[model samples]
Target: MEEIFDDPTNEHRKQELGGKDPSPPELLKKIEQLKVELVQKEEKLLEIDLLYEHVSRLTDKIRTAAESGRHNTLLLAKRTNELQKKIKDRTQKMMALTAELSMRQALAIKLQQEMRDKEHFLMVVSSRMDQGLPLPQETESEWLKILRNEKIRSEAAEARARHAAEEAAATAAGGVCSAAQRRPAVYIPDSDYSLPLPRPYGALAPFKPPEPSSHMRHYRKPIIKPTEI
Candidate 1:
């Protein structure tokens, strides 16, 4: 057991001595590797700082562009509203004008139709006049002819009545007297009527008067005496 313990102690001392004793070239190489690793780490930290700054600048530019777009959009909306109002006003005015035109056209058509009706009526009247139609009256032409014949017969009756009246007046007067008082009554004959008896002139002669006085004989014309002057 004493020999085993002495062997372990010796082995431990040898390892310690070996670990403490290092080569100069090996230490120098290890220090150079450590410096290279430190430099690489510093370079990676700088790249990260630069990337963060680039991202911040891009975000600022995007925010500014969005603000400007909003302003432009508001202006476009205002202009579109104004244009819509103008379009509506013009459309209403056009509709009113169209309605007025339609009314005028209707009135013109009505007047034209009335004129056409009047012209047609005139044409029909003229055509009827050209057909030799008689004027309207209470009696027709044949009835008028009958009335005219009755009027002519009435005229003849009036003439006969007048003749009868004249004959009555003559009969109411004194009878016609003859020159001779002793002669028989004689009637003169008319060519168109029956004759009565005729009397001789001697039987119809009046009686002679006595001689006139000297004053009455002086008023009468003297008889011419055929003597030698």
Candidate 2:
């Protein structure tokens, strides 16, 4: 009994039993109660350990999720910066292209105007030449020489026709009608009239003189003078 009380493990039991040795039946029942209480205390300790493990796992998961969220946010910010830079570069390129296009368009318009001016100059030159007008500060070109020769030829032809007509009139007034004058007269054809000469794209027809009519022909009649006085 002294040994039992001296042990620290039985001290609380000794106090509860009033420092007396318990009867066999009471000891048995007390031993059974102590065993049940020990089991209950061990079960409570096991439940506390399980709850701590669950809380530790949840804390680790929350920490990992926070780190991942921060990393993703950084990545999104970096991508946004890169996209903004690319957009700025693309916008500058577009502006350059637009300026180049405008310059090209202006150049094209200027070229077109120059072409129109050249065409107008050519038209004026062609029209002047066709009208037989004199050129500015006339140089002695081949075309000019040809034109002068044609004018001279035309004047000569007109003078010859006038002379022939005068001669026929003088002959008729002197009262001489010839058999040649009585012949059938050929009339001038409409196609023989003078017209503006065409450019030298084709063969140029030679100038033709007008034909004399048979009515213009006259014979000299012999006059009988009085017997030699």
Candidate 3:
């Protein structure tokens, strides 16, 4: 590098006397100039190192936040599935109720159809890609809201189904209609409930370190200065 920084053309027969050595004073002056340049280069390198360290810290924080959000989403997905299963169990019980044949033959056909539809809901609402992709907080919040609405709805639906089941039990026993006035509300599947998707296990993927850049090939961690000359 020092040779390259030297004069290119001959000013005082330097080209013809190329084999001759420089004077002692000239050599010292050249060494001083190189020292100055080295100091400037080192200062620039220091600035770059500080920048890389700052960038690395920020990147790590961002990834940690993303992982946390994804974990929360997985928990939400699990809770929602539990609620769905609860509702499905209640639906099955309601469908199994033995109503009076004369009054419920047509209703039996409808319940059977709904039961088949309920069978299709054995899975969950979350997509499997959640294994690799980070879930947004806003999306998690929306899911929470959906679950709250479903919770309220399931309570109402459960009450209706339980009442119907009791009525059928009474009819099976040949008991006269007890009045809370003899009609029981039927459970209808809510269209707002998303169709079931294949459920995926929520597990963190194994971490693989990123490849180092040309300048960073020597270091493994967040930062390490290059070897000095």
- The local distance difference test score of each candidate is 0.77, 0.80, 0.75
Off by over 4 Å in 2: 1-49, 134-229
**lDDT digits (tens) for residues 144-194 of candidate 1:** 999999999999999989877766776679654333434434545555665
Mind giving the per-residue lDDT tens digits that candidate 3 earns over 167-205?
A: 899899997657644232332334567544433333533
- Would you list the rank order by lDDT, best first? 2, 1, 3
The per-residue C-alpha lDDT of model 1 at residue 215 equals 82
Residues 1-229, candidate 2, lDDT per residue (tens digit)? 6777778876464544357777999999999999999999999999999999999999999999999999999999999999999999999999999999999999999999999997986787788899998654433475688899999999999998986787799797894644343332333334556445443423444445559767766856589988986
Q: Evaluated with TM-score, which candidate comes out highest?
A: 1
TM-score of each: 0.39, 0.37, 0.31
Best by lDDT: 2
Worst 10 residues of 2 by lDDT: 180-189
Q: Rank the candidates by TM-score, best first.
A: 1, 2, 3
Count of backbone clashes for each model?
0, 0, 0
Cα displacement (angstroms), candidate 1, residue 196, comes to 88
Alpha carbon deviation, residue 7, candidate 2 (Å): 43
RMSD of each: 42.9, 28.3, 44.5
